[model samples]
Target: MLETVTSPTLLVSERRVRANLERMAARANRHGLALCPHFKTHQSLEVGAWCREYGIEEITVTSLRMARFFAAGGWQKIAIAMPFNPREIGELQVLSQRVELSLFLVDSKGAAKLAAELSAPLGYFIEVDAGYGRSGVSWRDHASVRSIIRAAGHHRFRGFYVHSGHTYDAKTIPEIAAVHQELLDRLGELQSAFSDLHPIMAIGDTPACSTQEEFRGIDRIGPGNFIYYDLTQVQLGSCGLGDIAACAAVPVVQHKGEEIIVHGGWVQLGKDSLHLPSGPTIYGRMVLLNQDGQWDTSRPMGTVTKLSQEHGTIHLPESLRAEVRVGDLVGVLPVHSCATVHGLRATGDTRFLA
Candidate 1:
């Protein structure tokens, strides 16, 4: 299988991926929380099937297109984690009839509009901005939150969906725990305030989901990146480097002294970088591929220091640089596996290892 790689290919390890899924499922079960894992990471039906093996029937996707893809693939319960877009109402209506579709609502206006236009029966969750200012209604704004819930007139108000994405910026496990605690505190207050509605409390984010053990108020978790731990996860103390299940297999194109250029670039690996403490940024970690087509993480070969449109430069030491040649298949453990997979899949260059 290692010999067959001619271009930048996204390689997935079934063993590692299953282990990751099983671990997350166990975590959710231990806390008595429903695991509606976000499938926006791998976006592979093959990977989604693996989630079923662990008793995951509910899933969360980033878009309606992804929801349709998984719905056609037999996922009966799906949640579009992104904010509701009225422009996709036509497709949303079709999808709602096919599956138990749920959507995220951040504003009362959007909810009111949806209530008026939507004829199909579906559930909607209020996306709370729990310190992650990227989107969602501010957790501090109870008036806005209540307005959205009331505006969700006919649609079943599911629960609050909080993505404490800021946890990713934390440097330590304790920092991640602090973010989780704040989220729990906010959700607890929301649940208490809206006790009459009986809303389910839900939260999703790889950092908080992976590190925190006590999900005091969370009813459902939809972590996606945990399915394939990446360098970013490792840096955030969510997972170790050995737990990363995805790698970009690119052919060695040239050896320029200590730098080995590979066919993989931003087009294949994306531009997500990991800033090292040594004052340099790296796109990925290099590893040697064994004959069985698996990456060997035992030996740290080098780091992908630079990436252009069609090439990546791996800064290797003298001893390791001598071991590779042009046309040899080398592996790069991605900094952000989700973005990396998305990039490779866009070019139709990805393979799953059985």
Candidate 2:
């Protein structure tokens, strides 16, 4: 199967993906939290069907386009997890009529606009910033929170959507746990202050979801990256290296001394990189592809040292450098699976192994 690949190709492991979905679903069930797995990681309709096999009815996406894609694929309960963009009101209006739609709003102005423009009864979650600092109204800003909820007008107030992305910066599992606990405490305060509305507390971010066992105040878990654990997840101790389900199959084009150049680069793997403690940053981890089109994770080949637009430089260890040839197909486990999937999806060159 590897012989058929002539360029960069994303190889998804069906077995690994099912195992990942089952694990996350079981984790949610054990804690009695609704598992609305985010579908932004694997944007394929076929992957969404796999998610349903595990009884996932609700899902969260990052954009209106994704919501439309999954809604057309038959997903009824959909939430656009990004901050509400007023520019897409027309598109949002059309989509809200088709499915039970929900979205995130950081400010009351956006909520008021949605309330006035759309009469389709949409649900809205106030985006709360626990510590990620990227987006969301500050968790401490109770005034803004109240204003947003009040501005909902006729739209249903669905509670808070917290993505504790800061957990991704943690260097240890305990650090990740600490960040998650703090987030839960903040959510607890929000829930108490808004108990009258009975808002649902939706928290997500693979690092926190995968590491922390307790979700004291969270109502739903919508982590997307867990479906395809990558090198970053493994580095953060969220999952073992073997749990990674996606690998880019790139044809070895040249062997330059200790470095092997492949046909995969930023356009195929994206620019996401993992900075190692050993002083070097790597774009991805290389694995040996077996004859059956499956990667042998136990025998990691090397690290992708660099990536250009259409070329990747891999640095193999002395012992394994002699094993790879120019014509061989090398498997690259992405540093960030979400970005990698988006990159490959843009080129329309992804395949799943049955």
Clash count for candidate 2 is: 0
Give the winner by TM-score: 1
lDDT for 310 in candidate 2 is 85
Please give the range of 10 consecutive residues that has the lowest summed lDDT in model 1: 345-354
Judged by whole-model lDDT over C-alpha atoms, candidate 1 comes out at 0.90
- Residue range 326-352, candidate 2, lDDT tens digits: 999888999999988888888637778
**For every model shown, what is its TM-score relative to the native structure?**
0.98, 0.97
Q: Which regions of candidate 1 are displaced past 4 Å?
A: none
C-alpha lDDT of residue 277 in model 1: 84
* Clash pairs (backbone) in predicted model 1: none
- Cα displacement (angstroms), candidate 2, residue 348, comes to 4.5
User: Please, what are the lDDT tens digits per residue for candidate 1 over residues 6-66?
Assistant: 8888899999999898899999999999999999999999999999999999999999989
Q: For residue 212, what is the lDDT in candidate 1?
A: 88
